[model samples]
Target: MSAPENTPQTSLVHSAYRAPDGFEAFPVGIHHASTVVFPDVATMRSRDWREKLGYTYGLHGTPTSFVLEARLAEIEGGNYCRVTPSGLAAIVMINFALLKSGDDVLLPDNVYGPSKDLSRWLQRDFNINARFYDPMIGAGIAELITPDTRLIWTEAPGSVSMEVPDIPAICAAAHARGVRVAIDNTWAAGLAFKAFDHGVDIVMQALTKYQSGGSDVLMGAVIVRDKALNEQLELAHARLGFGVGMDDVYLVLRSLSSMRLRFDAHDAAAREVAQWLKARPEIASVLHPAFEDCPGHAFWKRDFTGAGGLFSVIFQPHFDERQTDRFVDSLRLFKIGYSWGGAHSLCVPYRMAGMRDGWQRQGQLVRFNIGLESPQDLIRDIEAALMAMQAD
Candidate 1:
């Protein structure tokens, strides 16, 4: 349901609107459609099920989802893209399409929390062999690929720790082995990291986060390069009944119009906060890909164009898990929450042990989802929390 990269300006081919007739001025309108009427029984019958030539049911495809997919494909520089109910659904579609019971999949140890959980489930339930490799594996991934391996899942700057991996190296290794490469590009949101440009065959993202521009809608999308793999995913998607709500699709489209602008704000504000926290005595280090202490700052600088609003800050030597909780609890501007990419700032504490590989990084991990707030105010809030932590 995505727009072609080489689409001519003649008209919006997939768009329900006739551009010659003059579409509405603002590009932010939400196209709400559940059931689209066909011209005739012949046309409906002739519709291609293998591809999204046309639609049959609401759950299958809608005008809003179709338009969103087109725009997403344009953004990701991919040939095809599809919308799903959530980010995990998009991952599941890719997995179910590419791998079978005996097939093997390589996943980076530094993946999204839910994605890691899903991989474990896929191993136990589907009997698909999935293994986790370190995010720093890079070109060394060539050593892990086997004939049975079908897919490789990677996430740049693993969620909590923000470790930007050598995406190109990883993709080259997987692609050389004739394996598919998919990434949770939700962190970069196609803004910081261009997946298709890096040889990624498939790009998966949580549109619910940055794309929605709000915390309301839950949506995800998967971008594919080849038609065959895209068709396979489409079949799995149809069988699984994975489709986004029409209203949610509308909301996502509404947010997408200003996606670049919102991402700009997020990047600026987050950099400010990260820089501020780095200078603070209560903060041990800033775990942002753009920062020096981050796991792969060199890779981030080399491969990525920019950073996002989400990052983590390690507390100073004096702070422990208890003080970290106290600081989070004492915050006024920041809410203790899991997800990011909303209008509100969020803070979540994670145990260093839960995401460790025998590394001796000393600090309680506090993930920050910076909102569209004034940097000065967020700085003030952090100062207050630090004061509270100091008093405690």
Candidate 2:
């Protein structure tokens, strides 16, 4: 049946479907969309999604995602940014974008565990070669770079072991050989250290940690200052069909505003706790980048403005795995878990003997992710746990 003249249908379709355009707000509007409607076929055909001139689909870009991307890029001093589902996914995207069969990639021996695993997979399935290098090698890394090397991966204050590398020196070596350098900048959160200023070509971070202070969101970002490199990443990112939920993007955006404050607070608290642990009788060594004894403390002192709340302590030589577990189980405030940058403290025990070459530590390793808790109270918790273990 034909609609009556001057019907309400036209008003509803026009007004409800299209809200007024000039509305302003403190927060960006949550633009949830899968398919975007074009004004006409001509506009749709003329739009180039690659240039970010306009959005083509939900996977490509949305206003909310774009806002988050822009803010993150600004913070990291990069020109372009791409958000991924998880940090590891960002790593894989970089690998896929930059590497192919027979190409070689260099990784720090103390690299993130899953990244090492992914490199192994790439070697097996794609015929790419993966080589592990010493985190402290710095410019000496040039000697290890073969003619086939395309990328060199660096991790500051190496994962779990807590050893900072000379990033500028490494970047110099990598760039001198025409090899791209990608750093896992999660620990620094782009605030402590300037990746771009140090000559790094790409900076990848796990936004799930500091960026989403609540630990309720899992997201990652790949940022690049170079337009050509950004274009390469953009093509691979779009082809991989990596789409993040709008709600998570909004959560990260909210957390990002207070990230600097939280990071400084965490840094201060962790240093206090690490120093307290250093004075303890049970700790064999404290692997914190701020301390003189840490593997690359000199480089850290030279490069970073601050450190994160993550650090590890090696127990006295006599402590066994079972004994260490007992100590960890005795803690009340610090829970045993994986991942960090949450409000609650976390602890994880590691057997470091087999993780890398030239295993030097003689005791159990315990990593702590200090949260927004009183340093004294955290120290008491550690004391109580040590007493409990000693009593047992």
Q: Which candidate number has the best lDDT?
A: 2
Each prediction's RMSD over C-alphas, in Å, is 8.1, 2.1
Relative to the true structure, how large is the alpha-carbon lDDT of every model? 0.86, 0.92
Report how far off residue 84 is in candidate 1 (Å).
0.4
Question: What value of lDDT does candidate 2 attain over all alpha carbons?
Answer: 0.92
Which tens-of-lDDT digit does each residue in 1-392 have in candidate 2? 98555568777665535566889978877888899889999999998777877888899879999999999999989999999999999999999999999999999999999999999999999999999998989889989999999999999878799989999999998888899999999999999989999889999999999999887988999999999999999999988988999999999998888999999999999999999999999999999999999999999899899998999999998988888899999999999998888878999998777787787779999999999999999999999999988885
lDDT of 1 by residue, 51-115 (tens): 66677777777656788898899888888888999998899888988888988999987788788
Q: Which stretches of candidate 1 lie above 4 Å from their native place? A: 1-36, 357-359
**Model 2 alpha-carbon miss at residue 284, Å:** 0.7
lDDT of 2 at 175: 86
**What stretches of model 2 exceed 4 Å from their correct place?**
1-17
Q: Tell me the lDDT of candidate 1.
A: 0.86
Q: Indicate which candidate wins on TM-score.
A: 2
Against the true structure, candidate 1 reaches a TM-score of: 0.91
